[model samples]
Target: MRSMLLRARRLLGALLLAALLAPAGAMAGPCGPYTTGNIPDCEPQQQAPVPYGILETQGWAYYCTGDHPYFWGLSSSYPGDFTWDNSCFSAIENVFPETTPNKFDATFTNWCLSAENIVVTLGCSSQPPPGFGPSCNETGGPVGDPGCPQSNISNHCSSTNPPVCFQTATETCSDGTTYSCTADQGIVWCYKCG
Candidate 1:
């Protein structure tokens, strides 16, 4: 009886091993269409292209006390690689001295290609306000104020956009063999006439 039990156990182990290994060979078939020469001619799958063009804006706020106008100096986190264009896209006065005495607040916008850290400096000079010297303050960083509006690039190549139409052409190679090619806005593919 013990010998019979050992034989049965060995048979079950062999059956399980065979079952596991059998599917591996069955799965090894041609994954795509083949040409007349039995060569695989798998068409490359297309992927969603990344949008390289980007337009974004950085926000800033400042407060100055004096009768003189204040000017802003902007700098980027990446100095030479990425820098502000030295011009503010937009500016608005949030607080005025008429409403609040000796206190003022204004917001400014600067444009950048990608997301970057922006630093703003305020400089002011006053002539009439003798006792009250020009005092300037800056408040901004990589990420600007939470209450301010931020800008971003819109996706123009998404599925919602129109499909790209490809142009087909035929060209002869150096050996005088003609090949068919297709090109879209930025990509071109050529295949031999087999």
Candidate 2:
């Protein structure tokens, strides 16, 4: 029988090559509990949607990290419009640096997103991306908590209020831990991820 149909076509090609070589942490990321992937230890996040009357008026959130990145400093200095108004920024690698509504799905509260936006800033170009200790700005300023509080309606934002912003509380920063914050003008607000 043609060697039993070539041994059942080599046992169905070794079970589809063992299910495509499994083990990317078993392709974790039904995204549940923010189950990251993409094997960079940066884990895979992926989110995209940033436009709402221009949140905090351009020029990114200036968070920081991505290791040494040449010791930072490249903000055209108080020069607004780093683009986002034209919208289109999610490169999708480690996306859940929290612009809004990740953790796999929580009603995507726009303007990047929130209600516990997991602060990243690992490449530190801007937009909540700084790095290298003190957990890098401890989730981004105004004594951050990044877990989104102040009665999280995605922590209420406002540049002209799409969902309205500013909840600003839960202090104890300067490395004392204790997070959950707000404030965009009183200085880049942030904390809370783990």
Candidate 3:
């Protein structure tokens, strides 16, 4: 009888230790209420288009001060759902997605987290996201462009999207100008290094 009792005690202790040492993701469920200074227990994750546009993106405590950091813009075209964690203080609303779609995300499908009158964006990984690249170069012209005229957006070596993510603005133009100190809007060919 004493031996049996001792064995049971040992088993219980081992089980408790195993539970404590298990991986964080093993239990499953949200580790949210994720806020500016709160790091939830779950692992950071970004998964999208799993079962067809089933977007899911979550991140723990990360200090961000810019609007862009909170603004999770879709990959130019893929859009879906209005989801937020508990910290956001907003409910999970579908917001009539099937009928209406808009260019600006704030209205219908922008993942915004708000706490204390502050709103931040958090985008989900899209349906497989985009592959390859999409670098934004000088959109030369399309015949009837509303005119993105010389609005201080000069021909500078820009840190554009994919295709040419990082740029080295070292071009000795025909007019004798090197680096990003040029002051003209002439046409020059941009070689893409992927």
Per-model TM against the reference: 0.20, 0.23, 0.21
Output the worst ten-in-a-row residue range by lDDT, candidate 3: 62-71
C-alpha RMSD for every candidate: 30.8, 15.4, 15.7
Per-residue alpha-carbon lDDT of model 1 for 1-194, expressed as tens digits? Answer: 99999999999999999988542213112211112111122112212222222354322233222222211111111111111223433344443221211122344454445543333333322111122211212122111112222122111111213422224344455565444333335443444444
Clashing pairs in 1: none
Clashing pairs in 3: 70-121
Q: Comparing 1 and 3 by lDDT, which wins? A: 1
Candidate 3 off by > 4 Å: 23-30, 33-37, 40-46, 49-194
Q: For candidate 1, what is the TM-score?
A: 0.20
* Superposition error at 84 for model 1 (Å): 8.6
Per-residue lDDT tens digits of candidate 2, residues 1-194?
99999999999999999977632233223111221212122322222433433223222232212211111211211111111222322212222333321111111222444322322222112222233212323433233234432333224332332332333345453555555444433443445533
For model 3, residues 78-171, the per-residue Cα lDDT tens digits are 2221233334242332223211111112322223332132233333221111231123232222122122222223222213232111111323
> How does each model score on lDDT?
0.30, 0.30, 0.27
Question: For residue 159, what is the lDDT in candidate 2?
Answer: 34
- lDDT assessment of candidate 1: 0.30
